[model samples]
Target: MSTSTSSTTPLLSLRGINKSFGAVHVLKGVDLDVWPGKVTALVGDNGAGKSTLIKGIAGIYSFDSGSYSFEGQQVEVTNPKQANALGIEVVYQDLALCDNLDVVQNLYLGREATSGVILDETTMERKATETLKGLSVRTLKSVRMKVSSLSGGQRQTVAIARAVLWNSKLVILDEPTAALGVAQTEQVLQLVRRLADAGLAVILISHNMNDVIRVADNVAALYLGQMAAQVPSESLSHGQIVELITAGRSGDLGLKAPDKEVVA
Candidate 1:
């Protein structure tokens, strides 16, 4: 789970990112860095601003203030299309697969290839097969199988494959293993690791500490609306990560405590 070298610039970097909804502040000067060929797990309790920060990264929501830099260049991503153009993709928790459609159909749902006036079924199927094979996915029996019939892990696999099919560089996953059995969870976690191994910068959003410890190269903990800490996963124990998530600090590794007022 070693990350890219320190001298390598991050694929995505956000500094002093701030966002709000009307009167409520959702993100407060949060900072995050996503390195190529590594998985950075985004961990936080509910209402910790993880979703807001990710949405900002995906261009689903624009940050009110912050620096959005991709590949060391500053840029403005105002919408999802912009994010996609910059090789960023997000696989939300819902999976977003069309159950009635086959695997190839789901993979090329919106951006289907065409031959003259007809759909290029042959090419699409071939590409789908290749993408799955490239990821070392072996559980799927056929790309023609309907998504509704596939197991939970297989469906997740399809979603992940679809994300990378567009040549995405940064892939963000939200609760990918939620509601899955132990075996299925392991399957998904392995796929997640493979993504980073293939030189893609991956952002994994999950509450499961074990999964984070198992696959993440770096752990980014969000507390309330602030970034608690971002450190190498191997450097922190499970309990230390839990403390950062819950209290915004694990000893000196996270946010410092505010000054106490004098009562005298």
Candidate 2:
């Protein structure tokens, strides 16, 4: 399955991916390349296997076939720890913050600083402040503010800031703005664009077409566990994308619509 992937080596590539569970084939011969400094939006309906494919890439599930490559080298990422070490971060909609804990504490949860076994709170807090400032995050009142006091956008910002602080190579966002208002959604989208501008590969999974069209540089649609379409966002119209997602293939893809007679 040749795609729009460039001739230049990709930062991350998945080739010949196949996954199944008790006779249910989830993915078949999937190929995708995520280059640095681009947003690849993955879109699909409910149960279209988008989440499953992500799990496979994130190392939650081992696939029966396919090779996952990073920086032109083939590697097996078998678990979350390996992915994290490789600078791959997945930010789900939940944002995964501790409401009771302050921003700094949440950011450095298990990975805390220590001075002779005692946590170096002062240093960590100071570093956290620097990170937030680097991202130009303004809504955050203080590094010591409890997450429970933060708004939806603030929580999302913290999650992304954590990824940026870790120098994430590939950041996967799952429905980043599903629960946010227009302003908050814009905030997340700007953060996403910033990540790409800084040369990080971003894979965004969203059901909202508007969000996808607005933030994506390229779009990949999954239909019924099959990668139905892979096209550059600029080359496609919204109607064409919708057709590709709802149907197996769109007219622009040169595949005949289901049960439709091919024109002679």
Candidate 3:
């Protein structure tokens, strides 16, 4: 696969992020960044606001306050299309595919290639084939096979191929390996790392500590809408990360509260 050298800047950044629903706050002053060629894992509990933060980034939900900047410029992303235009793509688990449609069809579903009113079958097929081949994803021979005929892992591959087709700069993947077997989980993890190596920043949210430890360059934990810690993967041990996830704090994690005088 072809690639460019590092450009020396973060592809995306979120600053002082906050989100609230009615009287409850979900994300409290969250700060995060996605550097090109790195996988940044966002870990948290069920209600730690990880999903909410992704929605705000994907434009599914508007933020109550804070900023999102891309390539050093702050812009408003009010809808999915706006986010798409900015080359920010989010791939969730469901593997959203049409069971009846073929791989080429799913790859170019809403935005199919065409010559006037006629579908450009030849062009679309060739491009889809090239994309899969480029990513070293060649588990299937026939692109015309329906989704129902493909295995779970193959279906996930199609979904990700579509994202890469869009030239996405920042891709957010939510529990990509949650439903697959051990082998399939490894398949998706390899794909995730390949995407980052191709220069697209990746944000992976998963409960599997092993997966995070295997692929993530940095880990950020969200505990009850607050950032418990954000540091390199080597800084924390396996048990330490798990402790922060379950109890919101871990003395062994080497994360000490900042010094502040409580009262005079």
Off by over 4 Å in 2: 1-7, 254-264
Between candidates 1 and 3, which one is better according to lDDT? 1
Model 1 CA deviation exceeding 4 Å by range: 2-7
Pitting candidate 2 against candidate 3, the one with the higher lDDT is: 3
Cα shift from native, residue 219, model 3 (Å): 0.8
Model 3 residue 206 lDDT score = 96
Rank order by TM-score, top first?
Answer: 1, 3, 2
- Give me candidate 1's TM-score against the actual structure: 0.98
Worst 10-residue lDDT window for candidate 1 reads 1-10
**How would you encode candidate 1's per-residue C-alpha lDDT over 1-264 as one tens digit per residue?**
654443367999999999999999999999999999989999999999999999999899999999999999999999999999999999999999999999999999999999999999999999999999999999999999999999999999999999999999999999999999999999999999999988999999999999999999999999999999999999999999999999999998899998999898
Please rank every candidate by lDDT, starting with the best: 1, 3, 2
Error of 1 at 125 (Å): 0.5
Task: Summarize candidate 2's per-residue lDDT along 98-203 as a digit string, tens digits.
Answer: 9999999988887898999899999999989998887778888898999999889889999888877777899999999988999999988888887787778899
Q: How much is 75 displaced in model 1, in angstroms?
A: 0.7
Q: Tens digit of lDDT per residue, candidate 3, span 1-264?
A: 114355467788888999999999999988887788888899988999999999999999998889899999998987999989999888887878899999999999898999999999999999999888888887888888888898888888888888888888888988888878998888888898898888888899999999999998888888888777777787877888888887777894524556798896
CA lDDT, candidate 2, residue 35: 77
lDDT of 3 at 236: 75
**TM-scores, each model vs. reference:** 0.98, 0.92, 0.92
